[model samples]
Target: MNAFTRQLPKLMLALTALQLSAPALAQVKAPADSSNQVVVPQVDRRDVRLPRFPSNDFEAGLFGGAFSTQNFGASAVGGLRVGYHITEDWFVEAALGRTTVSDEAFTRVLPGGIFTPGNEKLQYANLSAAVNLLPGEVFFGRDNAKPSSVFLIGGVGTTKFNGQRQQGFNLGVGMKVFLRDWAAVRIDMRDHIFSVDLLGKRETTHNLELSTGVSFFF
Candidate 1:
């Protein structure tokens, strides 16, 4: 054979080796493409905040005004109240009130008055549920304003007067204005109905009470 024939087989073997390694070289280099590579981005994050609300569900207060005993005329009355808010529209309260009713008017016309001298003290206690009927704002000036609400309330209680204990029912309407988030000013009008033995007769009487006071919430 000539030299060209002798080199042909070696050239064929080198070509076969290159063909076998082609796939391995392509697999190593294919991942270098930008589309095939996974790129991680560096990022900075910010904090997020939310709003807050207030919850003041319990309240206590003191009040003073006039109590009009059915026949004894109106007298100065003072009271205190403790309450719990059931919801934004409803609440329950327990109250105690005291006043003195004079029998001076009856004494002038009769020898013996309806009540004795020491028995003129009148006191009452009640547990009541109230509903907010009108909730609004009260403005004092251009820059001052207060939150206010009008409510209807009624409940059963006990009234003691002239050394007698009697079951009573009371109904009232009230308005309250918030002087601060923790304090408020309130005005109320109530009528207490009860039975009492006066001048040898058992009579059902309606005693009207009007009061204003300040309250605190917790």
Candidate 2:
């Protein structure tokens, strides 16, 4: 063997040793003390505020409509209502209404008619309970949207006509659109049923009323 050939074996041993120690040298170069450690930042939190809304629980309004008295034809009627909301979907109301009914049709057949003078004032008072079945929004234009609800109502009260008071039952459906946080417009269709004794016979009568009104909330 020549001198270069004899030194080649030592060179191979040195290279193998260097390769085995390289990984250990790389691990030592990495930081292990607190000064070079990774930091987790701590940040202060802020409070988030919630939005506020209107809280209206009572309302009063006036309404006018056509009242169709079973056999007395239709007449103009006006009413006032005061209501209290029991929940988001339920309410109670007290309503008082008045109308003048003409017995002209009966007069044409019978001279005396149901009422002596052919016309008599009719008044009613009702305590009603209402439930909101459909709650939605009413849009007037691209930029206007109002909250609205469709409700069903029923009640028991008394009707006064011909100098007599009769127990009456009323059922209705209505829609209300909020014009503002404190004001709303409403439309209602209701049927009032009662037993009346006239013409020497006792029979049940159905009176229908359709009305539109405005109300204010507090």
Candidate 3:
């Protein structure tokens, strides 16, 4: 019985040592071949490359927002766009917009000579190419499992106002917040520039527009 009691401690010590070495044993037996093995690394979901959403090649949408000029007053603007994604990160779009200048805006820009404020309109049609600045996911709630993207858009277009047509170019930044894979909310800020033949001299007018609406994927 004395021998057995002494043996018990040694046996217990042996079991304790085995328990400690079990992790080291596991380290030594790590699979040498990666073939036919699945290894997952910790990663932020946004960093993960999500598969391309099927049927996302084409998109069409409408947007409405405020438009204004540096020298002119603010006006209400509405527009629509049809876009085709050339790749995961690139797309081309055609957009059209019409802004109705307020009577106050028209009078504000007119020189103090004799003038009457009448209905005025500013309209534009543009073809732009945009690149995904951030192609997927919003930092906010991903309600309904939808992802959104922010992009930069720039292109050339024509603007007509006061019975005169001017050719110009524009630069814009926008965000598309997806409510569904096939639908999203789009918001944009764009700057327009063109040379207008006011009198005999051509002057450049700087116009800025901000708009938001929704779109559907085809």
Candidate 4:
């Protein structure tokens, strides 16, 4: 046999041995943990709930906003309110309101041809039922920062004006922005309807009130 032929078998064995050892040499081994070290598994975050609404139960508040008569334009109005939450979506409340009027309101604004005196002021009291019409939360910013609730309120009561008292009804919409478990900011807009008699003439009138204030709840 030739010399090349004689060395072929040895060369084949060396290549086979290298191929067999390559995989073992290429393997990576993790460093062993020390005896005193604790090994822990990875964890995931869990969901959580937020704080309760301020007026989630009983509530009391004060507000000062704006007032408007059907014919006399807009004026300033203010009021005090107390309420109870019968449920998550229902609330019972009572409010006392005072509004100012101008001389033009009596002379040029009385409906149904009634002529009124220069009414000094108008005062009202109402017992109202409110529903969380859209109690859903509002999220702002990229992270959806804060949430608030909105409601609708309506009811009937009495009004005193120009030395006379009469029956009246009101419908209002409001919002509550919770800052703490016991406090919130309340903003409201309301329309009040009542009958007025001036110079033997009677007619219905609308008074719109808007107010904002703080509320305390328990």
Candidate 5:
């Protein structure tokens, strides 16, 4: 009987320990499951954007000037220039003009000695590229008001004196006073350097010109 009682107490204590250990094991297993179920955040990628550049426009103008030769007489001259704007500050121009002078001295030495008065007419044409030292708007003004701008021109072309052809180079420095948006008045000092064949005499001539004209820009 005593043995049975002792065995019963021992069996009850074993059962109590088993019950406590079972709850602790269950708690540990629950924590492990929670750690595995934790969520990780995901990141998204995006594309970058950039800005665009500006575009420039085209422009043109017309002008004229007076000319004088070294050995020949001096006279007033007129001309037209057509230009294309390669940039805001640069252009290419083609110019054509005419001048008239008196050759009384040359006529006096004629063989007939009949006192012939000589009258000579001259014409010239040039193609040159010009660069604006300042912005065209600075001289011609903007949408608000008119202004004045300065520029320089240089080029190589041909000039005709009577029936003879001469290869030449032209240079000019000028300024434009803008009266309106599309129209402006310009004055420039131009030099024409050329080699001429005068009566089989190869001579170099410098033609200096002072001119004023109007320009229309588009």
Candidate 6:
């Protein structure tokens, strides 16, 4: 009986140890599962904005206005301008045009005492540099929008009439109303300062012009 009792206690101790060791093994496997599990962070993308495109390039247009000269009479002036963009805000423009001026209708007595009427016509061509005070996008708007822009121009060129030539300076301000991405209508006002020699005497003339035209860009 004593031997059986001692053996039974030994068996109980072994079973208890086995129960404790089994829980420790389960704890090890639990940590292994936790290590294998992954937590991934979700990411979100944001929209990026880009800079606007510039309008520096080639352009062409036609313009007309009224003009008066010292030697010539008052007339209508018409011209065409071809321009190249030198920078984002500057351009070089060349123009070729003609002005037809008429003399004031006054009764003039000739050496033979006969009444006569006099008339005169003159033509001119000019070149100029223009500075854009606003960006092209501001004038033409975004890729699919409409806007308005203003510009100032100054230039020096020559005018020829009836085998006579005069040098002059042109100062102007213009506004462009953009109708589309590559087209606009423009209006401009200018003052021309010129000098001429009449009968061996020098004379100064100031001519004012108001003009409207179509501007095309590529």
| lDDT per model vs. reference | 0.93, 0.93, 0.83, 0.83, 0.75, 0.74
Best by TM-score: 1
Candidate 2 Cα lDDT to native:
0.93
lDDT of 6 by residue, 27-135 (tens): 7743356777899879787899998885638889998877755544457788888888788678888877777654443324234221123444455567899998964
What is the model-wide C-alpha lDDT for candidate 4?
A: 0.83
Query: Model 6, poorest ten-residue lDDT window?
Result: 107-116
lDDT of 1: 0.93
Off by over 4 Å in 3: 1-54, 103-117, 139-145, 199-201
Candidate 1 on 127-190: residue-level lDDT in tens? 9999999999999999998999999999999999988999999999999999999999999999
| Model 5 stretches with alpha carbons more than 4 Å out | 1-64, 107-117, 135-145
TM-score of 1: 0.76
Candidate 2 regions off by >4 Å? 1-55
Worst 10 residues of 4 by lDDT: 110-119
What does the lDDT read for residue 188 in candidate 2? 98
Per-residue error (Å), model 3, residue 105: 5.5
lDDT per residue (tens digit) for residues 1-218 in model 5 = 99999799899999999998997887774335665686777978788787764332333455555688767657878878777778767878888888876655465675533223355567778898888896445522345645777899999988877567888999889887777666778888889999866566888888899988887876
Candidate 5 clashing pairs?
Answer: 65-211, 66-210, 139-147, 139-148, 139-149, 141-147
Cα error, candidate 1, residue 53 (Å):
9.8
Better model by lDDT, 2 or 4? 2
Q: Each model's TM-score, in the order given? A: 0.76, 0.74, 0.67, 0.66, 0.63, 0.63
TM-score of 6: 0.63
Give, for candidate 1, the lowest lDDT window spanning 10 residues: 27-36
Error (Å) of candidate 3 at residue 180 is: 1.1
For candidate 4, the per-residue lDDT at 52 reads: 75
